[model samples]
Target: MFRISQYLRELAQAQATGSYPTPRERHAKGPVVIWNLIRRCNLTCKHCYALSADHDYAGELSLPEVFTVMDDLKAFGVPALILSGGEPLLRPDLFEIAARARDLGFYTGLSTNGTLIDAPMAARIAGAGFDYVGISLDGLKPTHDKFRRLDGAFDRSLAAIRHLATHNVKVGLRFTMTALNAHDLPALLQLMQDEGANKFYFSHLNYAGRGNIHRDKDAHHQATRTAMDLLFDHAWAAAQAGSLDDYVSGNNDADGPYLLQWVRQHLPQWEEALRQRLVAWGGNASGQMVANIDNLGHVHPDTMWWHHDLGSVRARPFSQIWNDTSDPLMAGLKQRPRPVQGRCASCQYLSICNGNTRVRAQQLTGNPWFEDPGCYLSDAEVGAVSTPFETPANKHARRTIEIAHV
Candidate 1:
């Protein structure tokens, strides 16, 4: 049953990403969604969008709320769900939640920091009937420890990975880039190579959480153009080399939009459908996912909301900043600290890029998404942009190595 859920999810993702319209005119509303089970975390990392576990989470959503959310999600026809938290395993009710989601027939899964993933816990997670397990692994031990701020975390995570690997489970990796270790892209990428990771995602350090704090700012030290380009080039090469074929995905404005756009154009026929799927189901689609729970409680069509969340990169919020959609949050970020030179406006990639993250701009120049004239990335956006580029981000792709910050 778990295997079937994963297969279906992947097939749906591949189909949706291929630019081909669904065979069934009435498609599944969502393939997956993230449940921020609780905003509590065990680690205090350098660049966390959720910041530290400092937020008041004493009043976490009751099991009833989870059920309500699941019911709503069922209504929207969402199929999969990822239970997350500061560390989802930290929640004493984890087993119950996982079992319930699975009972509902949803492709249930959990994303964790792995600190609390003991042998019993791992067994329970598997027994709970989740389809896949996503573990945060920024890099190798040294690099990972530096970024995550937990010395033995890397080992614990490896244990969890090995445990999962030993099971009939689908495993994935998460990489969050930060300024502190921006220079070790190659080494970080190496970990991905070594692990034979099924699906790997690299994320830009978001300007939220502890990330909102000054230490989280990597805009100045972080690799923008050079790193992104390198990582893209490397990943594409790796893909062709047969090392990775699961298909990498993420929501970094710095790379995702440009890369996705480039990929779509080259693979034209499927671009529209893929983009629409991404735009509608990406990170910002949480609201829609919340409406899809069925009565008997079998979940289907889980939505990976990242692709859908960043609908626009220049819009404002209707309510408070925190409550706004990822699209508008990203969009509104671009307008801050207006570009110094008129070059970006005239640049071809201007329309595609999110002007960099709001905090990156502010961290480097006190303005969100404002191009730092001194940075190579800011200049390259307008310079190398062509009608089409063979690769998404060669520099970025190369700079990345296996480390675990995200």
Candidate 2:
């Protein structure tokens, strides 16, 4: 995640103390785990990465099973836990699991579609001592309902936000951008301000599950750039005004470099310092610094790698599976200066993006190391203008290696 507000407001302090995003010290301990507590959701979001439905999925971890995994995660030195699901509130044991996680000292968060967060639910969530609750909102009423496929989902979710805020819970808005909702971003930002939200998360659409089927709906490159510019403008203005509302974006790692370019154009004096800090940030930490545990105890490099399992937490401790690095996919992902091919291999800002999202490449080209189709930066912006172009044979060789590794 790119912490736009943090960088804009606290860059100097972060640089001085080495407490930036993807902090090295914290990463050394363990990855932040996004654990899907269940696979049942009331709403069928069009871009659902889990392809979740309302019915209970077979083999979902029971309360006792989740307790065991929480013990293992805490012992593994996992610093934080983001409890998620098709919609986590549907689980009968949601609060029980969350309460246990809090007792174990995990910086527990709840990622839910806020339609379920009523007054009672809000109180329970606040009582659970959740660090934050991220409620997904695709757009304004009409657009959001269209994407969510429910007529009143927008009202229910908006009410959920208000309910959480009334309880003094830190509530953030999570938006997954697409062509359908790109125009609503400005209004969403306004909504965040009007609702006194603690954070606003802009997620770039990735190709996975239902999202893969809807890839054409992904926002155009120019639209994405415009959105990033809007974010920069808002974040910078907030920083100047002493508003600490957190602004962040996820899925696209190129956002780091894009933000740097924004700084170059707007805050030129801080360009070099921010560049060095981003280099230290070391871009995408999928298989290493981020991880996912699905509803049934399978572990992934990150949430996006649902199709690629490293191992099952039921079979082995998460620490062992994460540190094993025996699996070729794990080894490749954990490797520094990852063996990325094509334009990614030559991009000067590769350090800032780490080849962007590998899953996108894997989805499109059947090779995880190939250049991510989602990277929107131009060759000139990335300083790859004079690099040797990748040939068909080179592409073929990469594919061969990928096949062998898998």
Steric overlap count per candidate: 83, 0
In candidate 2, stretches whose alpha carbon ends up further than 4 angstroms from where it belongs are 11-28, 385-406
Top TM-score model: 2
> CA lDDT of 104 in candidate 1?
77
Residue 359 lDDT (model 1): 40
Writing each residue's lDDT as its tens digit, candidate 1 over 132-182 gives 788887777888887788889999987887677666567777776666666
The digit string of per-residue lDDT tens for model 2 on 273-336 reads: 7898788777888897889999988999888889988888778988889998788888988888
Which RMSD values do the candidates have, in order? 12.3, 4.8
Superposition error at 21 for model 1 (Å): 12
